[model samples]
Target: MRRIFLVYALVLVLLSPAFSFAAGWRDGTYEGWSDAGPRSIQYAKVFIQDGEIAGVILREYTDRLVEKDWTCYDYPPFGEAARTLGTKFVEAQLAEIDAYTGATGSSTGWMQAVERALKKAGDAKKEKQYFDGTFLGRSEVADRGYYEVVWVTVENDKITGLQVQRVLADLSVLDPDTYEGFPLEMARQAYAQELIGRDNADVDAISGATGLMNMLNIAVRDALDRASTK
Candidate 1:
């Protein structure tokens, strides 16, 4: 009887990780940097039920508060902003797997830390339901076809991922000089900040990238409409 009990205990111990995450939320922490310069933003995230990421919850530091004049009216949703910032930072760490479109800097920082946390916990998946938007080919330009191509990924009626690239090999269409050092990376970074956490199918077209942005708007609309039917 003692031998059987020991075997059973060993089996459970060996299979611990597989059964550990049945329904409980996973908690994690990481540090993020601000774009405004030398500001250190520390963040934490709790993975709630159904595996949805519960944004970030920022902690306030005495030094930070002391540096600025104490003004309540000017302060926006501080917690919400931290979560937003934290979400981007976590997303940044997963770049090699798939990167966000517009909010690159923040995304990179968050993702870098997230990747470490996830790796340590063995929680990384190739693809997650993070984005829910549909992919609508590329945006059309004049006679040259698509000046810049756009791809949208959405989840929960929100735009979650976006990718922009020159359409195939159609280099003749755009002026090489203007786009040369423009850093095509900004599109991904912008999509991250502006689209995530917002209602899908109604994403505001990005300021520039006219036609490409419009294409993304249409894709988001289509994705939400499809999600509604289901």
Candidate 2:
């Protein structure tokens, strides 16, 4: 009777789903908590078997910041959010995912954690694509070129990312000091948000930042032109 019971227990344990996850998780929900400022953010992260970060949604929040001085006060730190929210099963390089506008604090916080996880899983690699960082269109020495900085990234023959650094004539709009810590990072984010999952030449320009859009158009055109030449 004892031998039969032991055999039955072994069979049940071997058949359990948790045991299968010991090999690998097909999908997992990673929970993250952050303390960047006054509020604590809780994250519910979802990922695929390939190690690509599929998606993440904020599961809970405590002390959500209210906007007043152009910045969200008391937001969570990016690293904590990233660590708490990222999964452990990814195996390929990762693309930077979009963060919600106006929630820059939370977005960056979660991104930091996500990036760490991707690195640990060996899914993301560094590459100098068309849009790795900030780029300025230079035609003259006298020009500060702040009005038209374009950010773009390409992968797999597709423009995977974009951003306009400064569109507002008033520098204060992009200034952290004047804007109360919001770094006018919107131009790039706006561009990136629109370009992701899009695979065409005809991209809709941002209305509020038309000047920046014009500059980005020229930059993207240049990148595409270079690709064609190669």
TM-score against truth, every candidate: 0.30, 0.29
Off by over 4 Å in 1: 1-137, 147-151, 169-178, 222-230
lDDT of 2 at 102: 53
Candidate achieving the largest TM-score: 1
Clashes of 1: 26
| Model 1 accuracy (lDDT, Cα) | 0.42
lDDT of each: 0.42, 0.42
Decoy 2 TM-score against native: 0.29
Give lDDT tens digits, candidate 2, residues 137-203: 2111115434443333455556665543343434322443354333345654675677665443355
The CA-based lDDT of model 2 is what? 0.42
